[model samples]
Target: MSTVGKRGASSPRELTRIKDRLSFIYLERCVVHREDNAITATDADGITHIPSATIGTLLLGPGTKVTHQAMSVLGETGAGVIWVGERGVRFYAGGRGLTRSSALVEAQAMAWANRRTRLKVARDMYRMRFPGDDPSGRTRQELLSMEGRRLKECYRRESARTGVPWRRREYSPDDFTAGDAPNQAITAAAQCMYGIAHSVVAALGCSPGLGFIHSGHERSFVLDIADLYKTDVAIPVAFDTVAESEIDVATRTRRNLRDRINSTRLLDRCVNDIKELLDHTEDDDLNDQVLLETDGDIRLDSGRNYGDELSW
Candidate 1:
């Protein structure tokens, strides 16, 4: 009983294997749990395993595996995992000194600037595409303009509330391993931003690797879109949560904040916004079939599809 797509087929042997190894993990709000770890999934069924090593700040979904080798493989694939729930997952990897407070501030500031730029671009595109239309078009254009303004205002207010000065400068792309505490925080915040970007690209049916702004990487587009959301969404959420709690920047509380960023309703709101943007796009093509890891079978509306039907 695996999810597949129409015109797709599942392999009987693979399906069985996946089903035997089936395990489900759930993370809601910043809490992670094994929903059904003991359940045996066959080869065809997909089971996501989170490495115990990265549990504090990160949570992987059911289709992933916990092994170091698996993680390396995933990173190589350029396909990132997303936590679909309210809180985005956060984790510190490789003992990199934590992100600096200033770095976090810088990241947020940059995010605000990026969001403003993108909104203006989007509005301009709309105006150029629908020139000389009726009042409806004009009204739509006004709404778009207003949305940009509102987002900018929100960024300003949030920055003030977080007590982080709005530094008007470009953020240097330093390695995560070199980040101090504040830098680590920035990285965590960026991870949430990336999640939003990934979701938007997914909804748009565009390759996250292929980006409009960011280039030369897997899911570069996602990275670009995520850059827009960090200041408006992820930054504010992370900053406010930390500030309100009066959590010590050096303590476990900061980690707690990072892990649970997705739990905030703000993250969910961003996801919804991404979905809406994608809905308005012209392309309607998407592959919704769920692949069964247990038996290498796919579930579609009509019936199970086998793996042999796949192109590769």
Candidate 2:
């Protein structure tokens, strides 16, 4: 039996070809095995096939057993593989690089390496956050302070809107169980956003660690990208989840966030946002400056940009 039915002769001939793209996926207490280009997920409810090419991120939560073959299929489709703890706590992730062109990555590195350009990028980031505002000559510290004040106000407003108790954002890296309901929900939602952000960054050929606003972390760029949507997406979802008197706040928040992500088409927005910030244009071309070798080392093409359309 085929996982997907064909519509006509011109329809996708390969089962691995995903017809519809999903924003994200979260699975727990299931077994995932690869059959051709699809992943068969089995649990108490029975088995269902997931097309690897269609998913933005596959969150392998607790009790999810996956085979090496499934991973191979997922990688070949340029999807993301994320491992999370029970209840949607992200542990780590891997993703297929969205583009072979190093144009975006090179631009990002160049901007981050220069102080003047980095500050300009930071200003652009702030401008992105406040679309109508002018960030000219705004110091980095001023931006940080402004961001903090805006966040507190955002949390207060959301809590008021959702009738959830307002409190400070708190989470400990060593202990996930220490926060209150809203706090835990926020953490879970943040993790989900991080997973999606990681996939976007990877797909765009951007460095996840090269962050302008934040630095010194493995997922610095992921954090930066995710931060742009946190106030509107994750924070609102967390507050609403807590206000609903749910038994599992984290789970509910994840669901709500996923819904919001889909409804808002967040992954698409993320890709566009990254490209805009990098100043990518229709005439732009990425050089084959970075090529992944069999040994996983990236090599340059004698310092020439690759002449190809940006696929991501």
Candidate 3:
């Protein structure tokens, strides 16, 4: 008795690439249902149709009710589905990745497995965040020290630029309302960035837990990726939003961040940066192949029995 029974899930080639899709769509107080390939959100205003493949991340905020058929279409189209708190400042859960290939994940694991490569990748991350500063030959502790200084400098600079009053960064994870306007906006922006980064990381088939600089958390890599753009995108957007008006700071910050992300093509940059960081050269047709591991670091096509070729 499902509408989705008639249509098969979309092939990788059929779905829009993650980089080409919209940054994210935040929905609330609506009933989401499937209509053909698109998902429809019906609220008091009216029913709005959104093409499933066009979304990079679908943030279902508090009071959003999504149907099974809607989820099916979203999954088929490779859209990242996230459940979040009001105004999307808190994350509750996330859906699966888009990619069927293991190439990028394999490369990530290969890089993470070794100490030298992991350190190099960590330094590279810092280098990306701190342009004009060579992180080369720096120890992890030195990199951390540099990052701390740069972060403080970023806060000071943004405060001066936007004229938003800033003390130290203070956040209470248990209570969102505990922070001031600027702090609240910064937290909201950071949460949004995490969702966005998680979407890209998942789409690329990389392990979210395996991180270069951060460790032990399930979303360690997601945090690492999100921080790469925090100073450049989130912090500025948050400060600017607060400077304009303190009212509805989180909502305004989300809107401004979305616009900035789209205009700056952050999604495309995010994808490219991940590939570059992992030192991966992904084939265009990686999604099309199902490969099996063979002896001596080779791959064989999957789905055929190899027992006949292997003599007992």
Higher-ranked by TM-score: 1 or 2:
2
Write model 2 residue lDDT over 1-312, tens digit each, in one string.
333233121212232222125667999998998886789899999999987778878889989899877776676666777888767775665756545567788889988899998888778888877666688888999899888888898889998898888778889876777888889989999999898888778766789999988899988988999998988788888888889875788888888898888888887777778877777754222322444342334444444555673233
The stretch of ten residues in a row with the least summed lDDT in candidate 3 is 281-290
Supply the global lDDT for candidate 2.
Answer: 0.77
RMSD of each: 14.6, 7.1, 1.7
CA-lDDT, candidates in order: 0.39, 0.77, 0.91
Span of ten consecutive residues with least summed lDDT in model 1 = 14-23
**C-alpha positional error of residue 15 in candidate 1 after TM-score superposition, expressed in Å:** 16
Compute the lDDT of residue 23 as modeled in candidate 2: 66
TM-score of 1: 0.39
The CA lDDT at 156 in model 3 is 99
Across 1-312, the per-residue lDDT of candidate 3 in tens digits comes to 546778766778887888988999899999999998899999999999999989999999999999998998888888999999977888899998788888889899999999999999999999999987999999999999999999899999999998999998989888888999989999999999999999999998899999999999999999999999989999999999999999999889999999999999999999999999998866542376788776677788889888868532
- What are the models' TM-scores? 0.39, 0.83, 0.96
Question: Candidates sorted by lDDT, descending order?
Answer: 3, 2, 1
Q: Arrange candidates by TM-score, highest first: which order?
A: 3, 2, 1
Off by over 4 Å in 2: 1-20, 283-312
Number of clashing pairs per prediction, in order? 80, 4, 0
